[model samples]
Target: MAGNSDPLTPRAKIAVTAGKAVAAASRAAGRGSGSVIGGRVALKLDPDLLARLAQNLDVVLVSATNGKTTTTRLIAEALRAAGPVVSNALGANMPAGITSALAGGSEARYGVIEVDEKYLAGVARDTDPKCIALLNLSRDQLDRAAETRMLAENWREGLAGSKAVVVANADDPLVVWAASSSPNVVWVAAGQMWKDDAWSCPSCGGVMQRPGDDWFCGECGFRRPQPSWALSGDHVLDPHGSAWPIRLQLPGRANKANAASSAAVAAVFGVPPQVALERMYQVQAVAGRYDVVQFMDRDLRLLLAKNPAGWLETFSLIDPAPAPVILSVNARGADGTDTSWLWDVDYTRLTGHPIFVVGDRKLDLAVRLEVANQHFQVCENVDQAVQLCPPGRIEVIANYTAFQDLRRRVGN
Candidate 1:
């Protein structure tokens, strides 16, 4: 339990202790990391556990369909320049996971929380964040999550009349619409490569017209706002129009966009872009994404792509061919049951590479790849997948639950 040493009230303290104990027991018993269960039990014991723990902390809530976890990790790392910061580094974005993270970081002055998109409204209403970073929202987990427009509406409703400084992505119309309702918003031209989900305007249900980077609706007259921060060819332009060149250890343009968003949020908390970028550059990977591990004497690098938008971004990060690519997917509860999203991803881009498909849904991936006319072998697991390749480096791109399974198998 967090604050077990007298800061919280008797009820909260007891609840915290009980939750902590349960989590510890669960971990010891090999059930899972006790993060979520402990937090859930604690919340049940004391409904105000989160509010009480977060009362004095300067919380920053980050939410989006994609990049929220990575953005949250980057924000926490940048905020650490001020002091020690605590976050749910384990990828737990729900209330229970969030509460556990906050409780664990009870002494830290700043709390950076990654929130699940559907739960953003409820989490924001409870956390009372000092700053909110809204990354782009796209079609992800559609089988379980609300549709894009409704999710944006929920975000707008949550931010209504709130004073939190919102750092939003101007390139994403969904994000622009959601943060538009916030009183304090700092718009950044964070690039959105996948624009399929933003064709319809959330404001007036009209077709959104996109002329190059500019987007507007004919009916509502809503449009992309002038950005206070933006991404140039290879640099991030600050509010002063001063261009700051950013080089990150993380790969792909998506991370550069993420860095721009993180820097914008950090600026609201008194950390300058130059400083924030420096701290962010130190982060090589989030959770296990982009982590390279030795498997069967071959180096296997991991990448997580949960949806079509995410898969598109992951494709940008793949190592050049001769380096074999393995695609893994699962439709577990963590991953939405519908595997239709696989159809939306352009797997034909890997037409020349040695591709191996493996997962609980490997047959689905195999079927998708076959329809695209891409050749791949369906493997039972990573061990079998890597056995087909010569000893060197391999790339493994997986969806939600599949990524976790591989992480444990690879000892990440």
Candidate 2:
């Protein structure tokens, strides 16, 4: 039914019929179970179905190695403060999720879809977004993504010579180089607040030398400059991390970068900078990206770390002296097919190391932790681990699916 190549094939018709039936039934049941991606069950609507919603709805696609999901949600929230908006707010960034968001909407002036870097080519080619935002690219899921350079090249091809305005992270050399010559590119960075730099040099192949808060390439003299719009604080506070006063939330330097990136997009969309900043200050944490929750007796924070960069950032934020750390490592099919990135994480920074390690891959992580000369309690189950993580200032580092499994167990 979706303009089939073989109109006479009953199988094709049945597939289309199934999609329609699923969509219809989901609508009737007030559910979100019909979205499809990679032939797997999708939690978001399909893009083809979304095309039928509104005519000429502006679509914004955000893709990156990290921070895309949170940044997209923040951008969507900010835009919603201004007007009605539809986005794949559920962290599903592939084609199916994009499709689901589009399909579920009836009247949306704008569509903001977070996209997976690997799926960007297909999604952008099919969706033809009016604007595409490339957040910072970092090393992530090496087995699936190959390397950062590969992802950068993929996105470069994905844009496909489009006229869409591109928003890039100028702080990230990879992003800066990827979108260097784009006509309408807007460069943004985390400004002077961030204090760490790793990865390849944008100027030359040599390592980037960090002289201070900024990074400079000694080989080629290319340095990270102050962006057109930059945050001035080490932390972004709505009410200074409190849900009261002004709906304050969000933590970590990476999240501040996410907020800054969202603000940059708002600027490109013609929203007044001050207005955007005000809206940004109103942002709360998106799920799994440092989202804090209250358990029966203690506070549980869920921080998703799917790759080396994210894991490193998580470690950097923990103060190395936080109460205790609980790490859940599940290399199950859902979290990922590869857990090699665990080796790259700076586990040595944890003060006395994580107190508990749980998941199907608990032993693997335990062994890794042991090699780092860090001590850990290997628990057979996530619930058992959570029970062992007593209150105070506990931190959790969970991979994609493990985060949900742990949350479900911990009752957070």
Candidate 3:
């Protein structure tokens, strides 16, 4: 009821109303927000409302710079094997947004909410999580966030005294170092993509050595042992619950890491390994994050690429599949204020001719595509872009705003 005049409400009624209107318009044009209610924009939380939500619940809080959406969704899916589980099905990661999800899940016994790094401390302060999963830290939204070091330091400080079982990714030196600070930690490591991004110890800036998936500083000897939960494989294990001797339908090497992280959580929750693995293959991508939509009788694999890291992994997914692609970019603030990160993405995986570029900022992406020495076609609008592609199978790499636009273009 605190829609219009609620001063303390973080989101104004006008903003929420406009968001709803936009969502409605997008759906009418084709794309759905999944929930028929559309932008169910729930932000401002009264003290009474907050207190009510915190009454009695065991919450699993998953926070990360990247991968939380897919990982959290995977955890929820795996947990479902045991009993009814509730989560922010729409990837609402902020406190107010999570509050909305909790309000919606009236009957859920287990609550899984993916928390954004900036809001993790505030949300955790209010509701102590039963288990906290911390994924890797990477450079993302530099405009909104400080360097990864600063953000990781804050996470280290904020989570100092929490009782929640800390589940962390150990492959990343920063994440591994953070877990070392906590006594009760469930570390997850991957020797799968064990390529060295870190040369020296994070603590002393000295050369580090990896002796059997265990990284330690040569000078300071700062080390975090191998994770209790480890995933060893040639390729990052795909979570799509695979049948005997076969992987699931989703594509991407990063998704294997995603599934591994979720599998660790399932282990913590006492879900059988076989059951967890089964659920992972069955788990699908959250809407807009590698979601495949059947549009105009053509299949469009929508990969939401918001950051450099996401784009990098998504590029790998597109490499093996010999499908024509539509690389969409948008300059809207919601998508990103600066599209300069396009430089950081490795587009070498993309090998083909006349890649279609769609977006309000089609010219910008067209310029980049051209520089890559690849065939390029610029579309004034998304509808025309999708029209150019043959029906049945096509790939779309979209940023946030472009995702909505892309959905509508494909007649979502």
lDDT (Cα atoms) of all candidates against the true structure: 0.89, 0.65, 0.68
* Model 3 score (lDDT): 0.68
User: TM-score of model 3 relative to the true fold?
Assistant: 0.81
lDDT of 1 by residue, 1-412 (tens): 1333445889999989999999999999998889999999999999988888877778899888888889999999999998778898877999999998888886687889999988887888887889999988888776898888899999998888887999899999999999988888999999889999999998988999999989999988999999999988778999999999888999889988989988898888899888999998889888989889997899999999999999998888887776799999999988999999888999987878899989999999999999999979999898999999888989899999999999999899
Error of 1 at 406 (Å): 0.7
Among all candidates shown, the one with the greatest lDDT: 1
Per model, how many backbone clashes are there?
1, 7, 9
The list of candidate 3 runs beyond 4 A from truth reads: 1-45, 191-201, 205-215, 234-247, 319-322, 390-392
Model 1 CA lDDT for position 157: 89
TM-score of each: 0.97, 0.80, 0.81
Query: TM-score for model 1?
Result: 0.97
Clashing residue pairs in candidate 1 (N, C-alpha, C atoms within 3 angstroms):
1-16
| Worst-scoring 10-residue span by lDDT in model 3 | 1-10
**Per-residue accuracy of model 3 over 1-412 as CA lDDT, tens digit each:** 1122223234333434444565567668765442323324433314334334543556788888777887788888888887677787777676655765565454556678888887777777776677888887776676777677677777777888788788888777777766666668877764334233366566777987877666778798777665666555523332333322214456666776667777778767788666786877776557656677887677878888777777776777763445778888877766656777777675766866337887777787777766777776787765677788766678788887888777666655
Tell me which of candidates 1 and 2 scores higher on TM-score: 1
